[model samples]
Target: MYKDLDEFITEYQHTADFWYDVGCVMASEKLSKFGSEDWQELSSIVHNRPLEWQKKLAYCLDTSCNMYELEILLSLLNTEDEELFEICIDTLRSFTTQESKQMILDNPSILNRVNDLLPKAGIVSKKMLEDFLKKLNA
Candidate 1:
């Protein structure tokens, strides 16, 4: 688990250090989000994967996250934490890449879940999600 998103991104991008390598990922809060491996305690604490760190994951959702990070990303959509929620929204909206659009299109559950959350979203977030959904559906 990362202390914040930058560290998560840094580690994933391979900009951390040459030493931080192979340990694809680790889940947040000491829980195994993906169950890939026992990420070394120090490395996970120091850094973790390599594209946006596996193509910069948030940007590569369509390329790399389809099977692994999708659930984590989806879970973040409901967070009340302002910072995290913002990152989630920003990362989600960045899915405008053609492949990312297809990622959402391929997963109807993404739409369904977003729709389900509409009634619960705050005014600002609601509007953002609405526009996001519209673009994807369009």
Candidate 2:
């Protein structure tokens, strides 16, 4: 429908209330995972009812979602990549112990690439990557 994550975020930033209904749809289609404690825990802080709500939410979550499943869910911003939806499953398969830095080290080369770009990225970017690394180290 939306076409891409960027598009979804953009649209949501403009009108996130739509997501209330979309969330309902997701619920109906068994998308309740988006409402789970993990999701709700994070959503509680980010889900603000404002014109810029979704953008802020995306920013907050993007920074905070260090775990693989949460990282994968961020891609939901991408609207057309239905196949990309498996990010969560793939992340789960590559699960890491909450107490192991090996998880970050164990991540595929691609995540390394993502990390590599961190220092040069903006504040949020650097913070997000750093947070992920922190979790791994924790």
Largest lDDT belongs to which candidate? 1
- Model 1 steric clash total: 9
Error of 1 at 17 (Å): 28
Cα deviation of 92 in candidate 1 (Å)? 1.8
Clashes (backbone N, CA, C under 3 Å), per candidate, total 9, 7
Per-residue C-alpha lDDT of model 2 across residues 6-109, encoded as one tens digit per residue: 23444543244555445324322332234345454444443233424333233333222345235434433332332232222222223345632354455565
Please give the lDDT score at residue 112 for candidate 2. Answer: 58
Give per-residue lDDT, candidate 2, residue 37: 54
TM-score against truth, every candidate: 0.41, 0.34
lDDT of 1 by residue, 1-138 (tens): 433533655544344332224222432322333244422332343223432333333332322433344544554444444444444544576455576677657767657666776898889878887888777766
Poorly placed runs, candidate 2 (over 4 Å):
1-30, 33-105
Residue pairs in collision within model 1: 12-53, 13-53, 50-53, 50-54, 51-54, 51-55, 51-56, 52-55, 52-56
Worst-scoring 10-residue span by lDDT in model 2: 82-91
TM-score of 2: 0.34
